[model samples]
Target: MNKLSLFYLLVMVALIQISVPAITVYQNEMVLYKGSEFLFKTIPLDPSDPFRGKYVTLRFEEEEFETLDTSLWQRNESVYILIDKGVDGFARVKRLSRKPMSGNSNYFKGRIKSFYLADGKAIISLDFPFKRYYMKESKAPRAEAAFERALRDSGQQTFAVTHIKNGKSVLVDVKIGEISLKDVVSESKND
Candidate 1:
């Protein structure tokens, strides 16, 4: 092909490649800034993935939902989890749906980790999309230690601050009470 044609082709390919990630970042930024915020109670532990590096693995208390029809859901199926604030102000699963809510924006996408019948009700365990809060290699171990200590204390509250909009969610921060986990680690270092 002509050099001018080749140049145009390469430029088109490059634009297409860049646009995908650009759109993703834009969407995530929008969610972080303009989306509704929810606090999800967390039980965390530290783990290192060889490919992804160090992160605090988060398990939410609001991962299970019960329904009467077990046949409607399947393992590993993508689902929309509708959330609403509980009496204590933490996010709770309001319902699950196969399709996105038409007029509501208070849902995030997740997968069904597993399900089982119990007392004729289907108990579904969900796999949240945002489960890893990555930290610098140096800070992760300290953060995990502090998180565990906070979790052990009955009075301390550990939770993740997440923002959700249009089926997308961003994990803003993990906090113990009003202080963030990063701040907690930093404070421990100062002590």
Candidate 2:
């Protein structure tokens, strides 16, 4: 092939490679900046992977929904969960949908973890996309300890602030009451 043609081919390949990550970053940034915010009640645990470094794993209290619809749901199948705030201002699942909700942006994409029938209703459990909150390595251990303490203390509340837009969600922060987890850890260290 001619040198000019080879150069053009390489350029095209490079552009394609760059565009993939660029689009993903752009979408995440848009959600973080312009999406609707919601607070999710969480149960957190700290775990570390050698390759990925340290992060806190977050499990939501509102992962299950009860419905009368008995349609078969396959594990790992993509689903949409509509969300609305509870009286306490934490997010709750409004409903489950096979497809994205039309004209509503307060929903997020999730996977079907499992489902079962109890009494007269079908209970659906969902796997949310934003499960991991990565933190600086130095702060992770302290954060984990703080999370554990907060979980044990009946007076403290731990929740995640998330932003959602167009079926995508970003985990903005993990906080104990009104203070960020990082700040909580730092304050505890100073005491």
Candidate 3:
């Protein structure tokens, strides 16, 4: 192949590699927002990465699933978690199943990272796909500090706005007691 042709090919390949995942993520985000909304509680552990910019590490409280039959469950097995609204209207995992439940139930899929039987209960830990929310580089640290302070002082709750559709899940936003970090930073800037 000619040098120019080879160079163009390389460039096209690189662009595809980079853009495909981004496009897929964007498409999934669209589906998620239009699908079903859920809320999951979180703890603030934001840290800045030079390459990845700034992101908050989300540790979900509802990562564990309990089942009566541990024998059928295997580590790294794909599991479907049915979601339901709690009394507070936040989405929570109703149950874990080997198969996705039909009807009006909303569900997301995850892999079982670990499972064990204890006291006749099958406890499963999942590797949820949506775990981090990338944010603007400048705003992350400030938001993280403010979120941490709120968490420690007033016992504030940080919850993630999660969206799920067709067994795929995406995190939409992280709210520090109902205020999104983006809004928090913007308001702070205005004030």
Q: What lDDT score is found at residue 10 in candidate 2?
A: 100
Q: Which regions in candidate 1 have their CA more than 4 angstroms from the true location?
A: 50-52, 68-71
Considering summed lDDT, which 10 consecutive residues are worst modelled in model 2? 146-155
TM-score, every prediction: 0.92, 0.92, 0.78
lDDT tens digits, residue span 53-136, model 2: 999999988887778887778888999989988998999898888888899899999999998888878888899999999988
Number of the top candidate by lDDT?
A: 1
* Model 1, span 1-191: residue lDDT tens: 99999999999999999999999999999999888999999988889999889999999988977877667678999999999899999999988899899888999999999988889888999999988999888999999888777768756999999999979999999999999999999998998
Per-residue lDDT of model 3, residues 1-191, tens digit only: 99999999999999999999999988786767577888888776777778988887877777876767656677799988888889987767777778777785478888888888899888878777777889898887777777777788888778898888767788889898879978877776776
RMSD of 2: 1.7
lDDT of 1 at 166: 76
Best by TM-score: 1
Off by over 4 Å in 2: none
lDDT of each prediction vs. the true structure?
Answer: 0.91, 0.89, 0.80
> What's the residue-level lDDT of 24 in candidate 3?
94
